[model samples]
Target: MTDEHPHRPRLAPLPEDGWDPSARELLAPIPRDADGRLPHVFTTLVRHPGLFRHFLPFGTHLLRHGRLAGRTRELLILRTARNTRAAYEWGRHVPLARAAGVTDEEIRRVGAGPDAPGWTPADALLLRAADELHREARLSAATWSALAADHDEAQLIEITMLVGQYHMVAFFLNSAGTPLEPGFTTEALPAATGTADDDA
Candidate 1:
């Protein structure tokens, strides 16, 4: 949650003075600021238009479809963002997570992870799934069983895919050093109550 971690932009964002026509089609789906500038993440990706074009459809599907509820999806995303220490991802999703009915306190608590107080059993399961995936790259049998009890096979698959997708996203944002959008702040959230090594 801390912005104290040094972040240096390795690739400059595509200048807004004149958008790349090659990437214009891909940029169409992304929300833009009043200045018509895309988020640094998208603009950074736009530097490779082919990859951005290919990545957007799957990303859009995950955001818009799937059996996972919006709240649940955001919970997983926020936790994954925290786990990876991806400040760009965390900053970008906080608003979307809030819009999906995640409380400010809940957003703050996500950094504390699955063990934080006040999460429902289902919410806890979602966080635990994300943590397990982040730490181990796969869910333990116990976590999988708990997830399967409530989520259908499709939803379970979406959960796994969503976590993996965000992990990839975090890697890109971190490695490329994507900056937070203008006016965005990387305020510190609560720290995790326990490490990922702790028993679930």
Candidate 2:
């Protein structure tokens, strides 16, 4: 899909030499590209060093310590990215989603949403929960019950927070107009089929 709003970034990425000491410290744990440059998202976010410092720990927890399975978390993030039309987030996570074992077909189907054919029950429930959260800010009774059946309370809570976290990340990426990293492509997945206007 063509970008509807290709606005230039309101906060441009900081040059490497321009990074604050605090920002550099916060970014230390993130892996660098072969060129030793940080990802565009990090570079852009570090323009606000205080926010970047506080945001990284929680994000690291979600990525490294969340109770949700890797594939499940990736699915939640990918769906959230699509729901929010966050091209930068979507592009960055595509390979991570794949490494977590989301198939190419399943990735494409994510754009079609929970009702799309061929999803296992658990996968469908995940997508439905993501859709409901994105559109309505709450899960339907049935979706909540379905999720509760398979996940422990901790996992269930993590799932909800995981989606919310990615939504916040997407909002920031889209609002700040963060560009995709070098060689990144947002076209790997299909265009999102569900709109914000669609009923959850």
| lDDT (Cα atoms) of all candidates against the true structure | 0.83, 0.83
The model with the greatest TM-score is 2
Worst 10 residues of 1 by lDDT: 190-199
TM-score of every candidate relative to the true structure: 0.90, 0.92
Candidate No. with top lDDT = 1
Per-residue lDDT over 1-200 for candidate 1, one digit per residue giving the tens place of the 0 to 100 score? 23454456888788765576777777877878766678888888888888988898899899987788999999999988888888788888898899999999899888777887899998988999998998889999999999889889999899999999999999888888888876667655345445455534
| Residue 78 alpha-carbon offset, candidate 1, angstroms | 0.4
User: What TM-score number comes out for model 2?
Assistant: 0.92
Clashing pairs in 2: none
lDDT of 1 at 87: 77
